[model samples]
Target: MSTHPHAPQSHVHDTLVVGGGPGGLTAAIYLRRFTRDVALVDKGNSRLRLIPVSHNYPGFPEGVPGTTLLGNLTAQLERYGGTVTHGEILGLRIEDGVFVADCLPEGAPDDARREIRAHTVLLATGVADAGLPIEMWREAIAFGSVRLCPVCDGFDVMDKHIAVATSEVNPVGHALFMRTFSAEVTLFERMSPTALTDDDRRRLAAAGVRLVDSPLLSVTLDASMKPVLHTEDGQEHGADVFYPMLGENARSGLAAKLGAETAQCEEIVVDVHGATSVPGLYAIGDVTVGLNQIAVATGQAARAATHIHNRLPPALRTASTRPPSPGTTM
Candidate 1:
């Protein structure tokens, strides 16, 4: 938090990272190498927040949990003397030549509302919850039953009967990934399914996956339908676990409103340097077009940080050790 005339505007930040998750945090570290005036603002709930232990994060031989990894990242960024603020950026608008981020102290426990005017802004706020229709989905999530990101939660379902509900829209993708665990695997297509090619049938058969093309009757914990998926077709199938890879929204409305071209798939559009179509605004991590793993997010952050730094004008650049000014509270 910095101060100035309006809200006690602080020293001009070389880069303002609008998400403290993987991409934003990584960007802060890289930005600090060139200029210490970078700030990372996040609402505090990362996409990986629900993740338990992540084996694919790289570097951790035993694999670290998502929260622990975030803690380590925060510690590393703070060590670089970068400003990491917990706040929710409610609105993003470009004022004059600077990007002005309007956020309340949502992520911070302290009651402080402020804005950051930076030479450049990175939109790492990421995506949102794509709508999903499921019985007991929310309750199970709150009770630590149903989970997101199979890579993060599949291990817990090992040796359990797993039900993968892929709407007619997306089929055949998760079969390979979810098969890492769950000995009894069932794939359910709610609508009429497209014909699976020989390769599709072969790979699935190799993995001991049963294919079911039927409309879902219901998913209940205590129903006689219990673990079994009682389809309208008068068939009984059991499932100790269920995974839905239906849809997800990449918190990209801000970038889209800014007029950046978006891909039709599940992510945002960005150049090799992680710069979005909008100049001075970049994106990275799960929200960006790359591997959604932590290592990839960390790498993307590092790359975007350097890219933004090199693009900065000489006047905006500061000494590597320069400390951020204290926040001017509102």
Candidate 2:
């Protein structure tokens, strides 16, 4: 809904936002409210769209569907005359003190690419979860049988039978976290059990988390629409909800290409204002090393937009506007 399919290719914007997730859209809104020329480009793969419903996000007593929330934000941006360009940015570089983004617009040919230029750039590209090997896993997610974030939806599964599946060498952490929400928690190690240390076993046991070391062969839904796990050892385990703790892949390649600092997990490192190591470039949301929540993303967007506005040259005004002294308010 935020997309402008026929956006001009040559106009340079004040700030170009990459990603159409909550953070990117929020930033575009703020920049537009500040009267700055802003352009947003989205590849249409935001993880927020995968959320069935969110109860943790404030102001939604009855909860809101993910798609509905995204649509609301897009609509808000449009009210401010801000539009998003549907495209996949293939490359980014600095040319004459401006950032240039080479993008493949949606439905364009492989050889066809467009260049978008901006004085500053913000990357709100979110992460992709390492999904389960089950067919129709997304359908299970929509049915509330498979969840992604424990911090976000653990309360919804309180006192319910929950299964945490992971291929990590040590899988006790998430299992223990799940124990706080439910009495019956199972940790399914989808890899060799020998990788787990004795400390991991003791911790899991102390937390009363059942450790099932058998490799996960497949996952299916029972007649009750609950997730039933099939182990390689010819065993079946049923649970009210399934959580894949396999981890995630951050979409920070664009920032990395500009020599931005990143963590071992490839999450972009940013300052308090969301500015990356590369000057005039910023990152927010799950792509940055921080809490992956909608509230956090919007807050980061606000801070980044304010900082960017202050950094850019001020527009013409009749009266001289200057920053107030420290400990003083204008």
Candidate 3:
């Protein structure tokens, strides 16, 4: 582990990526390839870590397991001389044109914290599912029986039994959207004051969607590992897949702490190149209010890195033969 005592010269990085998800890793790889010193700090709790298999992640016709994909990304980053650290960032601040970050190691002592200083910072903390009310939830996702992003995997459930689960005040739209992929669709309005207006009910009826107001009793897998949604009333709904439309909590505190502007859904607002309102501060991936997809994240990372590289002085610019800085720890 690299320990920084807030030394005047040590522990300084050209770029500090605050998440180990696809976005952060991609940025680290690009920045390192640009011959810039970069460090990635992550605690392994990204939303991507929960995906059992992503069939739409491109280049994988059969699909890729989340862990396997992360492993490959890490290997590639290390090969490019990017440092990976396992820690949770607690706070961020700007001082004298430098960004300072405090990170807490996963299992270290409470008092054992490290501070990292960076010329630039990339916020890729992503978002977390707001709430999921299901037993064996992780297993359900692993079996592809429960999904979160409809745009990413909606085609997989085409013409199959599907359910839309939402705890929002109104789930009519989500339920209707799911109906586009399957005729046998059910809306599970669980514990939400969610009600359908007469017009909403008529639309659902027209779309052949069944709306149920009962709260979910449980979600379990049978012998064949198929998902089964049980309701409080003794009604059982078996579906090939279910969508959780609960919501997402964007992990943009690091950006907000630096006084960056936020758009709808509290997502960190960034320019097309992923630069935040605060210069040298950038955000990408689900932390921004966009089409939260892996491909989009990687693209944002590449653009951000290129922009950052252009801002460097000609002498400081990285070169193919330039070795990494020695004082900074990975």
lDDT tens digits, residues 1-330, model 3?
A: 222223444567777888999989998888887777776899788778888888899999999988888899999988876767888889999888889888787898879888888888999989877775676888878778888888888888899888887545456777787777888998886764556568977988899988887777677777776777888888888877778786877888888878999976679989999999999999999999788999999899999988887886442534455556989754
Which pairs clash in the backbone of model 2? Answer: none
- How many residue pairs clash (N, CA or C atoms closer than 3 angstroms) in each of the candidate models, in the order given? 14, 0, 0
Q: What is the C-alpha lDDT of each candidate?
A: 0.70, 0.87, 0.81
Clashes of 2: 0
- Encode model 1's per-residue lDDT on 235-270: one tens digit a residue: 766666667665666777767777777885446799
Top candidate (TM-score): 2
TM-score per model over all chains: 0.77, 0.92, 0.88
Top lDDT model: 2
lDDT of 3: 0.81
lDDT value for model 2: 0.87
By summed lDDT, the worst window of 10 consecutive residues in model 3 runs over 1-10
> Candidate 2's residue-wise lDDT over 1-330, tens digit each?
112424476567788899999999999999888878887999999988989899998899999888998899999999988888888999999998889988899999979898888889999999977756775788988999988889999999999999998645336777888888999999888876446778989998988989888888789998877999999889999999998875888999988989999995689999999999999999999999988999999999999999999999884456656578899977
